[model samples]
Target: MTKTLPLRSYQFFLSIIFLLFSAPLLAQDEGEEEKPKLTLGGALRFNYNLSSWKDGQKDRGGDFGYDMFRINAVGTYKNIFLNVEYRLYSEAFGGGFLKQGWMGYKFNEEDQIQVGLTQVPFGLQQYNSHNWFFNLTYYVGLEDDHDMGIKYIHDSERIQYQLAFFKNAEELQFGSTSEIDPSRYSYDIAGRNKEINQFNGKFIYKLGKDRNHQLGTSVQYGGIYNLDTKETGDHHGFAFHYEYLGEKWNVKAQGMIVDHNPITPDTISDNVLQFGAYGGTYGVAADFNLYSLAVSRSIPVEIGPISNLEFYNDFGFMDKAEDDFEDSFMNVTGVLITAGKVYTYIDYAAGYNHSWLGGNYVDDFSAGNPDAKWEARFNINIGYYF
Candidate 1:
C-alpha cells in the first residue's frame, strides 16, 4: 500500500526554501564578513516511459510521471563553504527524499576537506550517460554513490586525487521494513546490514599534449553489519577510468569489480540479486564485474527551443562471480537537447540477459534454465535547472 506524503513535512520543506531565499533581504544591513554569500538552485524533472517486457506485454505509451524535484543551497564565506540539497520524489513506489548536505573548508588553492554527506569517489564519479537511468554500476551501488563521510581532495595541473572515510552509506528507503525494498535505481541494502566504516580513494592523471585526456583508478573498502546475525560482510572494490574530451567529441569508460567476502551461494534469490544490493543479491555471490562506456559528439546546429544538441551512445555489461549466472548487457542510444537551463534526453535503450537495464526483465533469472531475454524502453527525460 502507498500513502501520500505528510502535509506538515511538505509544508516544512517549502518553508525552509522560503526562509533561505528571504534571508539575504532580511540581512541586507549586515556586514560582508558576517553575511555569507548564498545561492539557491535546483532541478525539476519529468519522465515519460514506454516499456516492453520479454513476455510481449507493453506498458501504456503515455506513462507520464513527475520524476523528482531538488533544491540546493550553497553558502560561501572566505575559505568556508556549506552545501545542501533536498530532493522530493513523487509518490510511485513511495515518497523518498534527501540527497546531499555537507560543509567544507579550503586550506589553500589546491587542497580542501569536506564533512557531512557527500559523493563517494568511485568508478566514473559523475558518470557519462545522457539517459535518466544510468548504467548497471549505478544500480549495483558503484557509480554516483554517496555516503556520510569526510573527504580530502587535492587538485593540480597534472594530478587530482580524493581520500575519504565514511561512517555509513546514505539511506534511500523511507520506512522500517523487514521485507526487501527496492527503489527505482537501487535497493536498500542498509536496511538489513548497513554499510559502515567505509573508505574510498581515487587518483587521476592528465595526459596528452592537449591535456584533454585523463586516466584514473579507484579503490573502496567497507564493512556491512547484519543486524540480525550480528555478523560482518567485507566488501572490496577496484576500478579504472579513462576519458578524452576533444573540441566536439568526448569518450568515457570505466571497469570495476566489487567483491563481498563470505556470500553463500544458496542464498541467491530473485528479490536479492535484481538490484544487486550488498546483503541481498550480491550477498549470495562472491563478486561482480561491471563495465561502462559512452561516446558523444556535439552538433553545430541549433533547433528552436533547443539551443544545442548532442548525440550519444552508452554501453554497459555486468557479470556475476559464479560461473552458472549469465552475463548481462545494456545498450542505450540517446540525444541530449539543451536550451539554456532546460535540458531534455530522448533515448532508446535495450538489453539482454538482465532487466536492470529497464522494465521487468530481472524477475526471470533462475538456475535451471538459461534465461535468453530481450527488453527495451523508450524514455524521455526533461529537466529545468535553476
Candidate 2:
C-alpha cells in the first residue's frame, strides 16, 4: 500500500529549503537589526540500577555507572535560528549520536519552518512521560521521535499546528550496504525494512481560562522499503491526546493505533517488524493499539540544596492485533528532586511482556509469553545541568 512521494510535494520541499537558506541574504538587504547570539549548555548524568530480574546485581546491592553526557547549542540571527544537540553514552548504550540538529526561519511571530534532523510532530510535543524511561510509545517509535525532514509550525494564542515531510531517517553512513544500524538515539525500522518518504501533521486546541487544557490529534504515513523484496510497503498511525495543567498537578492521556505492512520475503513474518536503537535491535508488533496516561503533582520545599519535589506515575499498555500475541504493559512510579543545578529521579519501574523491562530480549514485544512474570527495576538517575 505504500506510495511514492508526489512530484509536487518533492518540489515544495526543495522550495522551502531554498527559502530557508536565502532568508539571511534577504534580511541583510533589508538592513540587519541585531547581532547573532549563540549559547552553549550541556549535562552530565549518572545512574544506579537494581533489577529484580538480575539476581547477581541484587546480591551486590546494585550497579552505578555513567549514563550520558550531552552538549547543546542554540543560536539566533534575526529571523534565522539554529538548534543542535549531541549526546555521548556508554558504548553499550549507543556510544554517541546526534539527537537533533535543525536550522529554522521565522516567517513572522506566528509561523516558522525548520529543516534538518528535527523532532517529528507526533503525539505529545516534547515527551509523553515525566520519568527517565519514557512510555511504551517511545519503544515503538511514536513518542519523541525525530527524523530528517522539513517542518512548518504555526503558533497562536489557542491553536497550534504542524506539518512535516521526512525523506527518510537519519543515515549514519551514506551509501552503506548495511540495512540496519543499532547505534542510534531514536527507534526506527532498521532491518530489511527501512522508513522513507514520511509525512506528519498535528493540530492542537487549548481551552480553559488560562489555556492550560489542550486537546490534540496527529496522523502519520510513510513508506517502508524492504531490501530483500525491493518493494515499498506502507506504515501509518493516528493518535488522540489530551493534557491538563494545574498549579500543582498535571495529567496527560493518549490513545494511538499503529499499523505496518512491510513487503518482506516469504521467510519472514509480517506480524512483527524489526526496530533498532541504543545499540540493539528487537522485534515489535506490526499492528497494535497503545494507550498511556500520566499524572504528576509538584511540591515546593526548602530542604538543604533540594528546592522542590515532583511525584509522578506513568502507565502504558499495548494490545497487539495478532490474536495469540500477548499484550505488553509498563508502569513507572517516580519522584523528581531538584537541587539547584542538580536533579535526580528515583523510580520503581515494572513491566510485563516488555523489552527493556524484562522478558526475552528480541521477542518480548513480538510473540510475548502469555505467562511472563512481572519484572521490576529500582533506578536512580542524577544529572547536573549547565
Off by over 4 Å in 1: 1-34, 54-60, 171-188, 262-286, 356-369
C-alpha lDDT of candidate 2 relative to the true structure: 0.92
TM-score of 2: 0.97
Q: What TM-score, computed on C-alpha atoms, does each candidate reach?
A: 0.80, 0.97
User: Cα miss at 203, model 2 (Å)?
Assistant: 0.3
lDDT of each: 0.68, 0.92
lDDT tens readout by residue for model 2, 167-217 = 888877665456767788889988888898999999999999999999999
Kindly list the per-residue Cα lDDT of model 1 for residues 1-386, writing each as its tens digit. 11223456446545544544454456455555664799999999998877775234353345777888889999997667899887777555345545678887766689877777788888776765656667666656676666777788898889999987776656545334342433323333433555657778999999988878999999988766554455566678999999888888889898888776433234533223223332234322336788889888998666676777889898887777667866677788999889989989999888776544443333422121264666788889999999
In model 1, what is the error at residue 73, expressed in angstroms?
1.3
Worst 10 residues of 1 by lDDT: 360-369
- lDDT (Cα, 0-100) at 275 in candidate 2: 94
